[model samples]
Target: MLLPTTLILLASLVQAATLTLKNSRFNITSKDATELRAEPLSVTEKLSSPLKLDRTDILRLTFQVVEKDNGNNVQPHQAFLRFYDETTDEEGIQPVRVSNTGKGKFELNMAKPPTSLPPTGSAPLRVSLLIGSFVHSPLKVELFDLHVPASHPPAQHTEEASYHPLPPLGHTFRPEQKLPPRIISASFTGLALAPWLVPLVLWGKVAPSTPRLFSPHILPFVTTLALFEGLLFWYWIDLRLGQVLLYGGILALPTVFAGKHALASIGERRLGLARK
Candidate 1:
C-alpha cells in the first residue's frame, strides 16, 4: 500500500509541471504588405523600445507552449493577451487561439481595431501574455509596450442631457388659491339657496294636510333619507367615500323595513275604505 501511494504522489508531481513559451516572435506589417519590424520575443526579458502602430498597420504574434522540464508541447486550458492602460486604469483581454500541438497565434489589425483593444491615449499600453492549465502551473509573460494611435471619442446619446440633474424644480403652484371677496361669496351663496324658499312659499300658500307625516313607520324612512343627504354633504366636507358608504349601508336595513311597513299600512287603509 505504501509503495502504491508513493508512486501515485510522484505521478501527480510530474503531471503538475511548469509551462514555458518557445519560438515566440512578433511582426509588424504595413497596409501595402511591407514589413516594418520583425523581432524574436524573449520570455525572460521585455522589449527595450515600445512598438508603434499606425492606423493601417497589422501586428502578429506567434508562440508555442511547452513543458519546462522536457520541452514537450502543451495546449493550456486558457490563453490570453492583455492590453492595459495604466493612466486610465483600463484593460482589455483578448483570447489567443492555440492548436492541439500547442502553437498559439494572435493578430491585431489596426485598420479595423478589435473591441478587445483598450482605448488608447498618449501613453503606451502594457502588453502581456497569460497561460493557465489545470494540470500545469500557470505562466505570465510581459511582452512589450504598445503605442497605438489615440482612439476616436465615444459617441454621445441624443438624449444624454435628460440624464443630468434638472434645475432645482421651480414649482409654480396656483398662487395659494386666494378666496373671493366676502360680498361676492355671500351673493353666490344666497343665489344658490334661493330655490329652498320656493317650497316654503308654496307650503304657506297651499297649507296641504299631511296626516301621516309624523307616523312612526313614515318618520323612520324620512329620517333615513335625510341622513343619506347629510352623509353626502359630510363627504363633500370632510368624510371619505369609504366612511360614507359604511354608514349608509348600516342605515339601509332600517330604512328598508320602515318603508315596507309604511307601504303595507297604506295598502290596508285603502282596502278598508273600499269595503266601507
Candidate 2:
C-alpha cells in the first residue's frame, strides 16, 4: 500500500539529515594532568538523539578559539582532534592547524578507514586541543554551524592490489637473501642492550643525587624511550615514514627531561625543601 512506501521515504530522509551540536566553551585545566604541566583541553559531544550516520559521511566543522587571557596573542595556532572510534580501541586523530584569526573552520573528509564509524555506529565524538604550550587559554568551540551530509562516496575496497617488485627477466632467478645469523644475533643483542644503555648514559652524564638503579627519572625515561623506539621500528619496518613520530620523538626527549624535573619538584615539595 501507499502507507508502506511513505514510511520508507520518511526513514530514508531521517537517515540523511545533517547533525549540529550544541556549542560550548571548554576549560583547560592542570588539575587533571599536573605532572605534564601542560594544558590539554577537550570538548566531547554526546548526541541527544543518536543519528544514523554512514561511515563515508563528511563532517564540516566551524569553530573558534575565544582566548580568555588579555594581550597574550600568538599569531599561529595548531590543534588536533581525537575522534572516538567505535570500531577500534585506539582513537583516531587529525590535525587542525590555522592562523590565529580567533575563528576557524575546516572539513574532515572521512575517507580514512580509521575515521569511519563502526558497523554498530558511533554515539559520541570528541574534538580536543592538543597544542602543548597554549598558555592555558579557554577554547570556545562552536559546533552550532556543523554541516554533515549522509551521502558520501562509498569507501574504496581495502584488499591490496598486487604488483611485481622486480622487472621481468628472461629465465633468470635471484634467490631471496636472508639475514645472516651473526647480524640477526647482533640485532637481538642490541635490542636488549640499547634500552639499558640510554639510562646508563643519562646516569653518567646527568649524575643525579639518587643512585642510577633507584632513580625515578631512569625508569620513566627508559620506558618512554623504549616506546618511542618501538613505534619508530614498527613504522620503518612496514615501509612507512612517520613524520609525526619523528617530530614526537624530538619533542618527547625534552618532555622526559621535564619529567625528571617534575619528579624532583614533587619530592622537594613533599620534603618541604623550598628555598628561603
Candidate 3:
C-alpha cells in the first residue's frame, strides 16, 4: 500500500507540468515568393513594431511545444492563434495543426483569407498564441499586432428592400346605397298585395259548408297544412331555411297519417251512401 501511494504522488506531479514554446518564428512573403519580413518570436515578450501586410501577401508561423522543466518536446491537446481588434472588440480564433513531435505550422494567405479572420479596419489586430492540455498547465503568450487593408462592405441582396415593414394600409369603401322614397315603396307594396283580395272575396261569397273540418279525422290534416303555410311565412319573415325544414319535417309525419285517415273515412262514408 505504501508503494502504491508513492507511485500515485509521482504521477500527479508529472501530470502537473507546465508547457512552453521553443524555436518559434514567423515570416511574411510577397506574391512572387520574395521574403519581405522575418523574425524569431519570444515567448515572454511582444514585438515592438506591428506587422503590416498588403492584399497579396502571405504570412507563415512555426513553433514547437515543450515542457518548461526539462525542455523536452511535448504535444498539447489544443493550440490556437487568436486575432483581436481593440477598436471594434472583434476577435477571431484559428486552430494550429501540431504533429505528434510537438512541431506546429500555420499559414495565412491574404489572397484567400480564412473565414475565421476578423473584419479589419485602420486599427491593428492583437495576435496571441494559446496552448491547452488536460495533463499540463495552460499557456497563453502575446505574440504581436497585425495590420491589413480595410475590408469592403458586404454586398446587399437584391430583394433586401422587401424585408422592411410595409406602410399601413388605407381602405376605401363606397357610401351605403340610398333607399327609394317611402311613397313609392308603399305604392309597390300595395300593388303586390292587391291580388290576394280576390280569393278572400270569393271565400266570403261562397260561404262553403265544411262540417267535417273540425272533425278529429279531418282536423289533424287541415291543421298540419295550415302549420306548413305558417312555417313558410315564418321563413320569409325571420326564420332561416334550416329552421323551416326542421319544423316542417316534424309536422310532416302527422300530416301524412292524418291525411291517410281522413281520406279513408271519407271513402267509407261515400260507400255507405251508395249502398243505401
Best by TM-score: 1
TM-score of each: 0.62, 0.28, 0.59
Summarize candidate 1's per-residue lDDT along 182-244 as a digit string, tens digits: 999999999999999998999899986778879986788788888889888989999988998
Model 1: pairs clashing at backbone N, Cα or C within 3 Å: none
lDDT of 2 by residue, 66-142 (tens): 33333233333455555543433434466665456534444554454334332222234433444322334333231
Alpha-carbon runs more than 4 Å astray in model 3: 1-7, 31-49, 83-93, 99-101, 112-126, 150-211, 224-257, 269-276
Model 3 over residues 120-215: C-alpha lDDT tens digits?
889998999999988888999999999988776434659978999999999889999987899999999999999999999999999878888889
Ranking by TM-score: 1, 3, 2
**Model 3 residue 263 CA deviation in Å:** 3.1
Greater-TM-score candidate between 1 and 2: 1
Candidate 1: stretches off by over 4 Å: 1-7, 31-40, 44-48, 86-92, 99-103, 112-123, 153-180, 209-276
Model 2 RMSD in angstroms: 38.7
lDDT of 1 at 65: 98
- The ten-residue window of minimal lDDT in model 3 covers 148-157
Error of 2 at 150 (Å): 13
The candidate 2 region of ten consecutive residues with least summed lDDT is 20-29
